[model samples]
Target: MVMSLLLALPLAVGLWLVTGGRALAVVLARRITAATAGATLLLAVATVAFGAAVDRAWLPELGVRWSFGVDGISSPLVLLTAGIGVLVALHAWVEVPPGGSPATFLGCLLVVEAGALATFAARDAVLFLVAFEVVLVPMWVLVARYGDAHDPRARTGAAQRFVLYTAVGSTTLLVGILLLVATAGTADLRRLADQAGAGLGSGTQLAVALLLVLGLAVKVPVFPLHTWLPPAHTTAPTAGSVLLAAVLLKMGTYGLVRLPVSVVPDGFARLAPALAVAGAVGIVWGGLVCLVERDLKRLVAYSSVAHMGFVVLALASGSDTGLQAALYANIAHGVISALLFVVVGGLKQRWGSVDLAVRRPALRETSPRLGFVLLLGLAASLGLPGLAGFWGELLAVYSAWTPAGDRPRVVFVACAVVAAVGAALAAAYALRVAGLVWAGDRPDPEAPRTPDTTGVERWVIAVLAAAVVALGILPMLLLSTTADAVARIGGAR
Candidate 1:
């Protein structure tokens, strides 16, 4: 029943949002969806603490099941998705697109949440894949429908690129899943693990892992395959960017950690050197791009490509330290990126641009709290020691120093050194953004004085800010919960 509610409620809210449009007022629709999101958040949080799961057969003859559950590995992500869903819905209420269809916008949001939650909770590989594809549709709609109104053609083009890239990734992922299922003889994640990864040979594990990594890499937007991200971020609306960086990006990393790395340990080790090289490239590439970026949102967007590289590098290490670091980094990136997009989005909406030379934000003079919050996020993003970002980068670097294998010593160490260089580059761009947006001298008299952060923005930022600090101050809060599950997956026990 709990599992039923978790998946069904948000899906129902989405269906209601779309179908109830003509019958229900816009305000009513928004309220309903928002309430649903809030309730879902509560359920997700409860799951994290109480530890609940559901497994029921869906296709008895073929051995499939409508299985959905959460362990330490998945619970935090579920909570993150639910919490972000609530905030995004509320944000939509305040910044509905030009078409003025709040119901449609909010409804698609609920659908995305439903899909994300289902993906996090799914216990069967087939169910995981199904939930995974479900998230793509609503997100594409958000990108297409509420894209930047000023330039319709660019928006359409960006949306098309997003569809093209993700579709290819999804198709590749399906092929991998089919192969694993064929060999394993079941779609149950639990069964596969207990059966020692389908009892396959090292060669089979290597082949399956390659297919899975190639498929998920597109979504992770790993280096060479990452062209789709900048354009999507450049054109999508604020809510779109927030969710893309915050929730959507995690899907790929989560899939990478859970499926390719965990299910095929020997294969992951075989590919670890290549993965480390690719991750190092992404980190340096993304940071270098951010250094030259002119637009604030796009700068943050590029930073995601770099930050996500840390996650990849950590996973490639295949140690508990590395796994913990990757998970922590994943959650940190989500919150930090969301905070950035919100503030940067507000900057764009108010001043008509986030470009530094075009118009000074003058946030220091006009809105101290907004300026300070932006500063805080910048500090956190650059991996200031007491913030959420610091711990992940620190440990990922450490993981590379003493990675699991002795043979890959040279490769892992080189990646670590490159990641350090990338961090320094991250600091350069972060300070650069902070200086331009918040620390400039008072602007010209003609510049618009954007109002200070609203109650809504303040509360949202406050909650996220608190999370960043809390996670930083008490790393054990997450580590205690996750260590056991991670150990189980990595065969550390």
Candidate 2:
């Protein structure tokens, strides 16, 4: 309970700050963010302390319990969520401009963080769904309120699109959940996993699985379903984009791991080919669009479509290695994409525009540190061997080449080859971006002057960049923790 409150404290403080008014709200907001960050850190530590500790029941009659616990699977994600929450809050100290009160924006972020923590920690399907939906409003408010004010439509449009798409997804997910509960007579995730295969019929199970996957697919925004993402990401503020890319998107992939496989293995097996095909299409489509994207942020947004394609593909393989690769890819994408967005956000702040053609000679000679950091992030994004991005793609391809179960070998092989080509296209776009932004001669006299990165911005970029490199070098740390859960989920099939 204390652990849960620790996660919730930030939201509580954010609410207090928002209600407190603008007069002293800045100070209050900062204090709240700091306090929440501190509490989250402590909660993360306590979670490690109380490893596998299942709490008391919430609804004994329904067998729906408040049974929060962590295993190898959820622990790392919880840590990642908590860590990013702290970093984002700290980074906001310098990033957030002073016009409007920071209280509301900060409060929204805290609420989102709380929701993310709960989503990952939840052991009951009802609890998980509630936490999953709770995150949407705060994120919507963040984009709607704090996004690019110069274009008012950007905020409103982005928020509306995000909400509309996700709401549909959530509705589908809710219907699926209710169906599962009614059929199974319990929403306890652990219990459901044990009985799901034996209890559900093939047709009914497949329908529920499709509902769950479609719900998650919108969040992952796979291929055609991904139309909502680029605009939202391009228009959203830095913190908003970071959270959306790094954490919120992961929720989709996480759901695939936690729910459908656990509760509807037969359905997953039936749908894996279609899922893999969608993933393959997303990889090719996203990469192609990225090649033509003029806006730096939008390009990054497109790249997420490509990166997440790898995750979906890995999951579709239905092998232990594939599941492991999917988990690894999720973490890798979260870190690298967050770093890319942060760097692009910094560029926008300095240059006053994200248009690549308009903003020529993009490297700031004045801010060599920022330039270097941007280059490092770009390298990671392109899956350079020494960076975090490499393993996810490599492992995904490897898993596809040698799947564990009854997956179609030829299809997996073809997808792997095509995905590798997508990776090459990734290199093309990444280099194109670096060259267009950082490689040309000095800008003409009339061009806008680029500002040097601030101390705070440098700190944020450096931390993320370092993390990218560290994870790339030592993936085992993450892989070891994720393996058991991946095995358990995949083993069900």
lDDT to native, each model: 0.84, 0.83
lDDT of 1 at 296: 84
Error of 1 at 332 (Å): 0.7
Q: Would you list the clashing residue pairs of candidate 1?
A: none
Q: Tens digit of lDDT per residue, candidate 2, span 1-493?
A: 7566755676677666566644564766677686778788688868866774556778888767887778777887888888788778877876774336787778777888888888888888988999899899888888877888777787789889999999999999999888888888888888778775567899889988999999989999788899989988987889889999999998888888888877888888888888888898899899999999989899999999999999999888888888888888899898898888888888888777788777455565656666777788778877899899999999888887776567788888888888889999999998887777776443555665566667867777778888899989999989999887766765566
Clashes of each: 0, 0
Report the C-alpha displacement of residue 164, candidate 1, in angstroms: 0.8
Off-target runs (Cα >4 Å) in candidate 2 are 21-23, 52-54, 97-100, 362-364, 445-448
Error of 2 at 380 (Å): 0.9
Model 2 worst lDDT window (10 residues): 440-449
Error of 2 at 195 (Å): 3.0
- Model 2 lDDT on a 0 to 1 scale: 0.83
- The TM-score of candidate 1 is 0.97
Instruction: Indicate the residue-level lDDT of 365 in model 1.
Output: 84
